[model samples]
Target: MLNRIIQQFGLQVQSINEVEDSHSSTVYKCTLSSGENVFLKIPYTKLKYQRELEAYEILKGRVSIPDMLEYWTGDEDCPGAFLLSELKGKPLTSKGSPTVAFQVGVLQAKMHTIHPPAEKVLNGIRNEYTNWSHFIENQFYSFAKDVEDVLPPQLYKRAIEKFEEMKHQLPPPDGPSFVHMDFRPANIIVDNNKVSGIIDFESVRFGSTEMDFTKLYRDFLCLDTTLYESYREGYNSIRTLIDLEEVLPFYQFTDAFNSIGWCKRRGMEKNALFLEENVSIIKNFIL
Candidate 1:
């Protein structure tokens, strides 16, 4: 069916090999008959497809995102596929060097400058969060509900109590900045110690700038003091750094709660270590 989609585009493909990355999409590395390389991504859900398509449409040339050569939404015959220019690098593996972190910081701060489409422009994007506290409150309660069976009863009760207390202290972010909701090392592409591309926009949203930092903090920033400061320096080069001390813990706790709910939904056994780590984070907040 996807092959037929390619045929419909009049794109003569030399080969298509699977790239195992996203859980919700079947991604492929394809070589064109014209000797160019591209990715063929067919997302499982239409919502995922729409988000990604709109993201690429908005973010082309402004940032280091994969170029969307062409895309076709699926009909009853087949699911949609995005034929994107093959971004030239692999996903980041380790906690990157100070240089890499700095570049990532600079890029992220720049990305936040591009505001998401207005509500009238984008009708059904679920992530176009208008009110900052409202978005957090909704996610907190929603994920909390999901994790009730996953977390210990005592911890679950405390999570509810802790969230109510913390909700009042939620910081007002610098305006409605465009956010890459899953900004992590895995979604970053590096080549020659520089960030070449940022991928995975299915989770892109309009929200607080700080919301983007939680995952980076979890996966990258906490690993080393030098890296954190370097990242701060780079971000500050664009805009003043927010008071992370005031904001990080609140978002971190919520991030951890979201992870627990996610692990339970996906399955707890294979994600045992991740679940344990997030549970520990919850413990720190509620203890």
Candidate 2:
């Protein structure tokens, strides 16, 4: 199948190397005949291909996303879907530099400028909200249930009650924006202290810009506070509407729950340590 693809594109296949393998997909680095580099992402399931393709289509020409060369569905030759695009530069972490976080913040700010279909955006949020306080009562409570076994019952109860009490203080959700639901450093690629590209649009959904920002603060900030400040500067430079103080606690709580859930799912001892530490941090702030 790969041979046929190379032949159709009139390119020689020098070598194919596995880049990253995950539960959903496996990416390969392929050097073409003209010495050009490209990446082929093969998904484990057919459903993932459709979501990725839709996301790519929506994001193309609107942001610093990969250029899609070709996308194909299941066939006798290739059983699942594949995406071909010019490979971007190395991930920010590869350089062992701290500036990448600032670049990510800048890129995220640019991404939020994109506008997805409005009705779709509204519908997605409506589906998640059951009432006026649904964000706190339903969403956070549901997340807590998933990690209940690992959490301190008293602290967990206080966190939920505090969130419920504070729920009314939150302003109405902001105007919808194109949000990369999973905006982590891993999904970003950087070179020369600048973001080369952003990948992994599988979780692309239209919602509050804070949803994206919260993920950034949760993951990258754990490494360095300076990085978080840098990112905030970049983000604020592009859009000034975000209320950082109000959202900080919510993000902290969400991050704690998310970390515990991840640790439980992966059964990783290091993640367990992280969960405990972050839980302590959240408790300190809430109490």
Candidate 3:
């Protein structure tokens, strides 16, 4: 199929290599004869194919994202839609550094400046809670059943109960900003110690800037005060003061459950001790 696409585009395919395999799709790097590289995302579902294409088109030069070359639905005759864009840099996790983190912070702050069409924004948030406390409560309750065995029985029950009791004590959501809902390190690409591109827009939606920042807090800082402060300092270089207190509890709760899901999917329970620490943090800090 890729060979057919290369031929159709009148471009020579120098090499093709599988980059990453996600539950949704298989990503590949295709080098063309012109010396330019393109990233091709092939999803298993037609819906995901359309969503990713829409996201790429919506974000196109507005932000530093992969440029879409072509999209076509695959069929018994065709196969699957092929997303082709200029191959960016390596993922951040593969090249960890403070400079890359700072660049990521700046890029994210810039992305927030783009407001999606107002109607789309409203529709996205229509049924979603705009209050921080309620947001935390709702996500916890929704995932509680799946995470029961991951947490201590007593702590899990207490956390849920505390969330119920304290629902009204939290602050309202801040002004809505464009949120890269899954802005973790793995989704960002860095080159020469700087963020060159960001990928994985499956969860892009209008929401609080905190939603993006929380991923940094969980995956990068992990409760390290100095690192957290450093990230905030980098972020503030582009934006203004941001109070994260209201979002901290939500971050803790979501990070715990997210880790459980990640571990289960990856079959890495050998790190059960690491998961135990996450639960402990949720109990002491979030509960």
Model-by-model lDDT, in order?
Answer: 0.82, 0.65, 0.64
Considering every candidate listed, which one attains the maximal lDDT? 1
Single out the weakest 10-residue window by summed lDDT for candidate 2: 121-130
Q: Identify the runs in model 1 with alpha carbons over 4 angstroms from their true place.
A: 9-15, 31-35, 77-79, 117-120, 124-129
Clashing pairs in 2: none
lDDT of 2 by residue, 159-249 (tens): 6676666656676665467777667667777766678878876556556665566655655665777776777777777876488678766
Candidate 3 pairs with clashing backbones? 74-79, 74-80, 75-79
Residue 264, model 3: Cα distance from true site in angstroms: 4.1
The residue-by-residue lDDT of candidate 3 on 1-287, one tens digit each, is: 66665565566778889875344577778787788788667676655665566567667777788767777667664535565675356666623666666676677777777665554433222223255455556656666766676666887777666656554544565446667767877777777776777787655555566556766676775545655666667778877636777766656666666566455544646757756766676667554
RMSD of 2: 4.7
After the best TM-score superposition of candidate 2, give how far the Cα of residue 271 lies from its true spot, in angstroms. Answer: 4.3
TM accuracy, model 2: 0.74
Q: Judging by lDDT, tell me the better candidate of 1 and 2.
A: 1
